[model samples]
Target: MQINKDRDWEALYLANDTFWDHGEASPGLVDYL
Candidate 1:
């Protein structure tokens, strides 16, 4: 996983500006977990 320190992107995501949030665990991640 990559981490971004850009404040603009961080703020946007924190403020719900992102378009994708499945509200569930990803299948691949769930499998790994």
Candidate 2:
């Protein structure tokens, strides 16, 4: 999959901000767990 290389996307993964608790868990896999 293609990922965004934009500053905002970088910030999220870098812990500058959160998009789903900063990678706590992917909701899609939560059901299997």
User: What's the TM-score of every candidate structure?
Assistant: 0.40, 0.27
Instruction: Compute the lDDT for candidate 2.
Output: 0.62
On lDDT, the candidate that comes out on top is 1
lDDT of 1 by residue, 1-33 (tens): 245575477677688776557678889999999
- Ten residues in a row with the worst lDDT in model 2? 15-24
1-33 per-residue lDDT for model 2 (tens digits): 345665577666586565446446776788789
Off by over 4 Å in 1: 1-17
Lowest-scoring 10 consecutive residues by lDDT in candidate 1?
A: 1-10
Candidates' lDDT values, in order?
0.71, 0.62
